[model samples]
Target: MAESSPVRFGILGCANIARKVSRAIALAPNATISAVGSRSIEKATAYAQENGYPSTTKIYGSYEAVLDDPEVDAVYVPLPTSLHVKWAVLAAQKKKHVLLEKPVALNVKELDVILEECESNGVQYMDATMWMHHPRTAKMKEFLSDSQRFGQLKSVHSTFAYLGDTEFLENNIRVKSDLDALGALGDAGWYSIRAILWTTDYELPKTVTALRDPEFNEAGVILSCGASLSWKDGRVATFYCSFLANMAMDIVASGSKGNLRVHDFVIPFKENVAPFYTVEDSWFGELAKSIHPAPSEQQVNTDLPQEALMVTEFSNLVGSIKGEGSKPEKRWPTISRKTQLVVDAVKASIEKGFEPVEIIY
Candidate 1:
């Protein structure tokens, strides 16, 4: 493949989330949708038509055909969690880069297997955590990294929730125990956990403790849950994720000398611009009447949506590997593993009667 060529994407399965990713792949300057596959040719054709795939895109009845297509440089896997390990591993063996959806696996053990395959096959691998590629995220990271602006971190709090209507609760694959076993924790909490880790420079917490009284469905899948993560230096991070609450995606972190807050950390309210707040070197007035330093809002603007940026970034990495013989990025898989480890620990804590679980790493 030429270094300047766009990475061709082959989407596996016609999942709802794939609708957004399909658009991202098209919008990305360095990527294109080459094929789509489903259980039936009719379904695949319908999906391609409904999703506005280009006429050049091929429709395959089975996922294997997409993987077998020589024109496909990569495959986007948005299949159910239970099917991830099987298909993702096969895709890697087939020499196709993988852009997998979040909650990468049911557990870290499963994720390791997938990551190992990608590594051995020398294929680029990245999970679809769109916010990480957003321009606003990078801007906020710049602010957080500035010692003069945001000093040593003290605590972090995040909440990601959305009210799932009755139909969605009953019909969505996320609530199905056999499909998405982690449920709300895997769905909403993945973002919250990622936010915490991102702000903390990808540091794994020392311990995790689940809050009491998690809500669950009849099939015993978690519907809502919260947990606290603590580090040895007294830094603490708390997150609440649910499918039963009103829509909210927030992150608030306080440092020794600065505070940072963002209302929409997962998905921006608007596609083009995102906002965040910060207060630095603030001090109470002489009479304790008011603070000396007022909080300021920072808005980051982008021409492309965050999801598109994600596709562009992933495609760039794919291009590098194919054009320059570069190794796959290890940081992404490591971050995914850390997030899953915390998730596993929180579930363990909830099952152990809210006991604090010590994280070995």
Candidate 2:
């Protein structure tokens, strides 16, 4: 990378989600999409053309070509979970910073392999959890951390679901056992698990118990599932994820002194501003004397969307390592691994007759 140049990104596999991240990379001040690769040259070329990729962008027929390109500084991989460990590790081994999609791997063991590769190669690794980069997320956390208002956490409930029509259920890769084996638990539940972890300040729960009513598809892949996580302090969190229900992504956290509610924690209804509600100590005995209603605490505003912010943040990290000789940031991969650990525990609980599975980590 030359002085004052943007971090050039090479996109691998051209998944549908790549379109969103591609636009984000183009919009970010410190990032640019240098190349896009797929299994076929026609698809790569046509995708770049149809998606409005810059004329300067290179098109490659194979993922290996993108990784071999000397002009590319980093890669954004939106491949299926099954392919995550392979491509992510390869990207790191090639000395390319990796911005991997959510549900980083099928298990913690796979994630550790990817993380080790990045560490050994001295490359940055970040999971593409766009909401974490949002300005609203930080604002919401501030309230939860405030002792005067939120005090101590008691319980949290999270829900993420969307109706999958006839076409998606029968044909989508997520429904395939070999592609996204965790299905709804991995796709939608990952967000809920992350939200619970964030609310608890990244504390690993003592145990995880599946809700005992998980629905599976014909291929034995999960379509709907829920899990309960409990901590030693008696703090409990429950999350529901599904592909059979209407669109709903919500979080309700009740603490000793106050409560917090977010209607859309995964993706806000509006792109520019996100709102969260909070209520503190209040008393009620009569009809209007004791009952207190929480109002929107803040409408967090941002100049760019969360995905663009994510791209910018990742680019800056890559730039620091390339320009300032800074070591790779360890915070991101560490969180990603912790998130995967909980995911694995949830899967185990579901497999073992929905019994409570202790979280060793």
Candidate 3:
């Protein structure tokens, strides 16, 4: 690959989420769609055409064909969770950087195998947690880190949910046991868990306790769930995710000196700007009748959507490895693994009759 050329991406599936990611690849200044592949060549072709992929983009009938393409520098994998380990490992083994969708694997054991392959093959690995690339997220981190204003973190809460229609509940891959079996936990809770981990600077929680019984479909896929996480220092966090609630994405973090809140944590309400609220040293009035000051709202603007930024960042890392002879970035895979570990712990807690599961890592 030339240093000045955009990173060439090979999409491994025609999953619906891949449509959005294909646009992100095209929008990213450092990346371009090189190929799209699926079990059906017609579907792959249609996906490429419908997504406005460049005319030069190749369509392949099988994922292996995309992997074997010498021009492809990276792969965007949007396959279901059950298929992630197999395709992701193969992509890495083929010397292609991997931009995998969330719930990277069925469990930590599977994720470890994928990571091991990427590590051995020296290919960059990043999950499609687009919001992490948002400038608003960075701004929120700055506030959380401010000792004088935000002070020491005390607790955090996150929620992500969207009411699913009848068709979705009956036939969506998310509700299928053989597909995204982790269900709503893997779909929506992934973001909530990631948010909690991010606020704590990637620190592993001491324990996880699933809240009560998780609602599941007939196929045994989770449809709604919540969990509580605790740290040795008494810092605590809670999160809820569902496919049966009104759409909502929120995160609230309280600290000794201040508090922070974001209603749109997974995807911003608007593509151009994102807003969050915070209040420092909130206190009662002299008469103890009311709070002293209102929370201040802050907005962060971006020219490109967060998903595009995610692609740009991942492509830059791939370019560094391909063009500049740099080592794969460990930060991304580390954070991804941490997030998965927490997710696995929560699931374990739920399976153990809501007993607190101690996190080892």
- Highest lDDT: give the candidate number: 3
Worst 10 residues of 3 by lDDT: 1-10
In TM-score terms, candidate 2 sits at 0.97
- Arranged by TM-score with the best first, the candidates are 3, 1, 2
Q: List candidate 2 stretches off by more than 4 Å.
A: 1-3, 285-290
- Candidate 2: give the clashing pairs: 283-290, 284-290
Q: Quick one: best TM-score, which candidate?
A: 3
- How many clashes would you count in candidate 2? 2
Whole-model lDDT, candidate 2?
A: 0.92
lDDT of each: 0.93, 0.92, 0.94
Models 1 onward score TM values of: 0.98, 0.97, 0.98
Between candidates 1 and 2, which one is better according to lDDT? Answer: 1
For each of the candidates, the C-alpha root-mean-square deviation to the true structure, in angstroms, is: 1.2, 1.5, 1.2
Candidate 1's TM-score reads 0.98
| Pairs that clash in candidate 3 | none
Q: Candidate 3, after superposition: displacement of residue 296 in Å? A: 0.7
Superior by lDDT: candidate 1 or candidate 3: 3
lDDT tens digits, residues 80-159, model 2? Answer: 99999989999999999999997789999999999999999999999999999999999989999999999999999999
Mind sharing the TM-score for model 3? 0.98
